[model samples]
Target chain A: MERWQVVTVVVAGYLLLTLLIGLFAGRRVSASVAGYVAADRQFGLLAQYFVTGAMIFSAFAFLGGPGWAYAQGAAVFYILSYGVLGIAPWYVLGPKAGRLGRRLGFVTQAQLVAGRFPSRSLSLLLALLSVAAFVPYIMLQMSGAGIVFRAVTDGHVPFWLGAAVSYLVVLVYVLFGGVAAVGWTNVFQGIIMMSVAWGLGLYIPIHLYGGVGAMFERIADARPELLTLPGLNAGGEPWSWGAYSSAILASALGFTLWPHLFMKSYTSRDDDTLRRTVILFPTFQLFLIPIFLVGFAGVLYPSPPEAPDFIMPHMILQTGLPALVVGLFCAGALSASMSTGDALMHAAASIAVEDGVRPYVRLTDAQQRLLMRALVVVVGAVAYYFAIVQKQTLVFLLLTAYGLVDQLAPPVYAALFWKRATTPGVLAGLAAGIGADLFFFWQRDLRPFDLHEGILGALANTLVLVVVSLFTAPQPEAHATVYVEPEEEAAGATVEAVA
Target chain B: MRARTARRLAIAFFALYALVLTYPGVLPFNRIRPLVFGLPFIMFWVALWVALAGVTLWLTHLAARRERRGR
Candidate 1:
């Protein structure tokens, strides 16, 4: 077989394997809503680890991560910084969320928030924001898949066909399995992702530049600026501290706020499962060291790919490695893309039914499941269309979504931790934060010092939430206590936790 | 509760992270000339803290375990 043929056959086999896993994982699923969305809350610690880890490490981390390292230099550290900073809060917050999930029978983030701050409009608004944020994110995964297919096939697979074909695999499994499929598939893919990341992250530098230290030595000697702090601008000059600082802050806040990851908190079987997930998450963050190394290895190569996002695939193709390894690299990248896309497709569909349409109309469990299944196709269709045509940088597109989702942080944090925050306070804050974010996003002028728009929005949102809650009547004390200190705290505490 | 103490420790841990990983806390380590692990000093500095953040959180995890035992 020809080299590309070998690559194609290997990649095709990997996709088929993924679909089979998704199809079979659902056999154990319950017919009830909880089973579909939260995996019957049966995921043990290991499953919980991979599910949450896979949810966070998406196409952006796979492709855009290397892209940032190759394209933006020191700015890539922001990715590393935020993943840890983002989840560290979860160590404290994740158990509270898990407890509340069980006690109130809440699975989605908006459900929890609206439960605390009672409003149909609030539910609908959050649903809209989450779906809006999710589409681009899913688009990110889709396009990341497209990039892999296009690169690996040497343009035989066009961007549109690659994205469509890849997401079809994602849609089928997600539609059938729901969160169970998302969990199992992540386990299967997470194994591939880490191995591929380490192998290539180490191999590329060693292959081209002798070693990672040797590669950095060359880059430092040639383009000293790429090695320093305060990162490079799009123009390749020094980036401002305000931009650097806020990007880290905004990303960290946005991490736990994502609709899918927040929902995954409910899937954890116990508090220790949630706590252990946070502690182990940083090791996954270690994967970035290799990812960035892979990108940095591209720095001094003669004839790098025109677009920085294409650097890794371009390097893989250019290198004369065995075709099987090339195919595995393609599969690894696909793993990165599909693992997150499945979660996103499932989350978007779940939100559309549970939070978006539920308050307006009642539906039976069977009916809601049907709607979510259909919406998976609908959301998948929209993201696929955008992925085929959209021209934005994959990492930047993901960041834009993160900025918008960042608005959810204050309201979510308030719901879990604060006793006094009111419904109007949370609602008004959402409006203010999202409004400011949209306006600044369109205008493109920094408020000053180049702080990211999301950081500015978060500040505005928090201010409004606090001030409005003080003036407005608080959520009823009895209602607030359910969240503030749940009735079943003892029951929720694991023996390992309480012993 | 022990959960509350664990929560406080986690908060303090993240604060220390924010200090080391951002802005002025990271300001001192920004240099290209000194290389660690074949990484530029700034890159190595960030990588070091990334490793440290894991260690710190693991310690907090242990502390929580200790608190649980005490309870």
Candidate 2:
């Protein structure tokens, strides 16, 4: 059969399997709010890790990682650096977030912040920001599926049709099964993704360039700049280090702040589970080193400037490998993209219901679940529209969300750790940060420094939070106790009732 | 909570990471050697720290189990 035909069959089969699994998950779980949002909080470390891992992987790993490495060389190290930074902070924060979430019946990060501060407006604002930020992220994943479809089929299957077929499966499964389906599918997808990553990471290098050492040696001989730190495209300025380092810092700190990642904390069975997951998460980063090798190989291929992003797909095609192996590779890429898209769709829907709908309309457990399922379609369609329309670089789309998500952190950190942080202060700070980020992003051409627009926004946000918090009256001591106390002291008794 | 101890540990870890990241340049060129598993000495340390964290978490889990039993 033609490669495109093989691609179509393999992709269609994967989607069909996913839809069946999702429907099965829906039938298994009780149709309650807890079942829909938190998987009834029954998830253990293993399931939580897979879900979190798959969520973190995204299309960025399969497509953007190799693309960036091909174009920028060693500068791609910043991507892995962010992963490391992102996972490390979870050790302290994840447990605390999880503990509070369990105790307060919090379903989203917005709920956690809003409950703590007693500010419905702040919660609604965060819900809006989350939808706004995640829309582009969801779009990027859809676009990545489009890119993969176009590549494998050689443009036989249109991009929109490919995205529609894949995402419709995701929407069906996620709408039916809720977090349980998303988590279980993620486990299956995560294994496939990691195995394929390791296989390709080892195979392509050995197959094409003899071995990793030889691959690097050949690239170094041809383009010595490819292996060096700060890399070849360091612009003309020495101050690029500041920009790079800050970008890494912002990404690391900002990653855990994203709502989807934060929601994973709620899935963990205990504090120990959260810590175990964080400690083991770095192993996934080790898998990424090989994908970077594919980009390194691109140096020899000499890609066109306008089409650097397609280098990895082109390289994969050029291998003339068996259709089965190619199909498996495409399945792995789809896994990475769909896993992320499912989580984003679920999170966005939950945010709409928990933070947006719950405040305005009193929803029963069943009604909330139904509303969430409906919102899955709504959110997926909104994201699909953006995916079809927007043509920005994946990195640009990612950074835009990262900036807005980072704005959320100052308030979150304050609410968690500091007793003095007031509701008005957090609300004001968040507004300033988001406002500044949007303004700077619009005027990106005229920025004073080469730093990420988010960094500037974060600084303004932090300043406002500090200044306002100092002047405002503190939260009552009783209210602050909920966040500061240990899990056993705060929620052990209550959690037992639910369990 | 011992604020000073946590603060100190955080600072020490940050400093250690910074040194490890920059150590290739700090060391004499002739003295440096690629270590076990074909990774550079500095890169090996990154792997080491990651492994250490895994071990620490395992130990913490054990401790938590013991505490649960005691209760």
Candidate 3:
């Protein structure tokens, strides 16, 4: 058989395995909305660990990470630095949020906020913003899948067919299993990604340059610029420290605030499970080291890929590795894309129904579950159509989405910790923060010191939240205490009972 | 150590990590030479901090657990 055919068969085998795991896992959950949206709040340490890691390191990390390392050099280090910083706060916030979620029956980030603040429009706004961010983000994951298939299969499978087929599999499991399927498949995918990343990461450099040190030594002699921090910009110009530092700061702040990630706090089996997940998180962050090595291996290769993003597949194919290895690599890349894509689809649909529609229309629990399932398909179809048919670039929107997501942090912080935060203050702060972020995003040249728009927006958001909250009538003392200083002993007992 | 003190120290460590890994703080450590364990100095620097963060967080968890058991 031809090599591409062999590769295709292996990939097909992998996808079938993923489908079986997802479908099987789906059968174990209850049929309630909580079951679908929050995995019935029973994810233990292992489940929480893989789900969080796999979702965060998406097709972007698998493919774009190497691409950045290949073309731009150390600019990719910014990606490396922020993950721990982003997740560390979760150690404190995760259990606290989980406590609130269980008590209030909140399964979404906006629900958590609107629960504290009690505003319908605020919930609607959050739902809208989250979906806006999620659609383009999901579309990008599809594109990443298509890119891998097309690159590795020698274009036997076109981008459209590749993306459609893979996502069709994703839609099935997510529809049937809900978050349970997402969790289990992520466990499967997460293992594949780490193994392939390390296997190829180490193999590539040693095979080509004799050792990891040798590869770096050679690059240092030939392309030393790639070894330094705050690497080159898209234009290949030297990147300023201002842009680099702010990228780290903005991304770190916005990381856990992504609605999908924040909601994961609601999925943990117990507060301990959540805390342990945060502690174990850096091991996953270390996986990026191998991923970066794969990109650096391509730096001195005889030929260059058409685009830097193609570097990983380009290297695998160029090196003429065994057909089986090539196939395994393709499966790993798909895992990265599909794991993230499923989470986005599931979260977007859940958020839409829970926060977007439920407030305006009163629906039975059965009706709500049905609506969530239907919306999952709808969200998938829309993202797939844009990914395959319209083929628009969603990178700009994804970046803007980060800035928008950062605006969520202030309200969430106020809800859990600050007692004085009022509804009007939250609403006004969200509006001003989003406005400032957008203003700077569009007027890029006007930014002071080339700072990320998200940081600027956060500053505006906090300032407005503080000022506006002081001027407004405070929430009743009784209501504020429930969130700010809930009796820990009672909360812990309830959590244990539920578990 | 007291749970509160441990928590305070963990937060301080994370804050110091944020400072030293970015901007003016990172400026001193960012370099290609003096490769440690086959990684560039800056790369090693970032990885070291991340690993240390894990240790710090684990200790904080233990401290919190001890305090809770006492209560």
The fnat of each candidate, in order, is 0.82, 0.06, 0.72
Q: Could you give candidate 2's per-residue lDDT for residues B1-71 as a string of tens digits?
A: 23344435544654454343332332332111343343333334445655554554455455555666777
What tens-digit string does per-residue lDDT give for candidate 2 at A1-499? Answer: 8887886788778778777876786677767887788887878888888888889998887788887777776556667656755666777788888888887787789888887888788989989999988999999899888888788788887789888888988988898889989988888889988998888877777888877667666766676554444443424222255455556667876888899889878877788888778768877777777777777677786444335556666777877777777777788888999999999999999988899879878878778888888999999998999899897767658877888888888888887888788888998999999989889889877655566778888889989998998899988887787776655345665887889
Q: Candidate 3, TM-score vs. the true structure?
A: 0.97
Root-mean-square deviation of candidate 1: 2.9
Ranking by TM-score: 3, 1, 2
Separate DockQ for every predicted complex = 0.76, 0.22, 0.84
Candidate 3 lDDT by residue in tens digits, A362-435: 99989998899899999999988877764333333455668888898899999989999999999999999999
What ranges in model 3 sit over 4 Å off?
A389-398, A488-499
Evaluate residue A131 in candidate 3 and report its C-alpha lDDT on the 0 to 100 scale. Answer: 91
Docking class of 2: incorrect
Q: Provide chain B's TM-score, model 2.
A: 0.54
In order of DockQ, best first, we have: 3, 1, 2
Per-residue lDDT of model 1, residues A1-499, tens digit only: 7887899899999999999998898878898799899999999988899998887898899999888888788988888888888888788778888888897899899999999888999999999999999999999999998898888888888878888888888888898888998899999999999999999889989989888888888888888777766778666778888888888998998988898998998998999989888889888888989989888988888988868889889888877889999999999999989999999989999998899999999899999999999999999999888887788888889878987999999889899789999999999999999998887777667566788888888889999999999999777777787787774544456654877
Local distance difference test, candidate 2: 0.76
Q: Rank the candidates by lDDT, best first.
A: 3, 1, 2
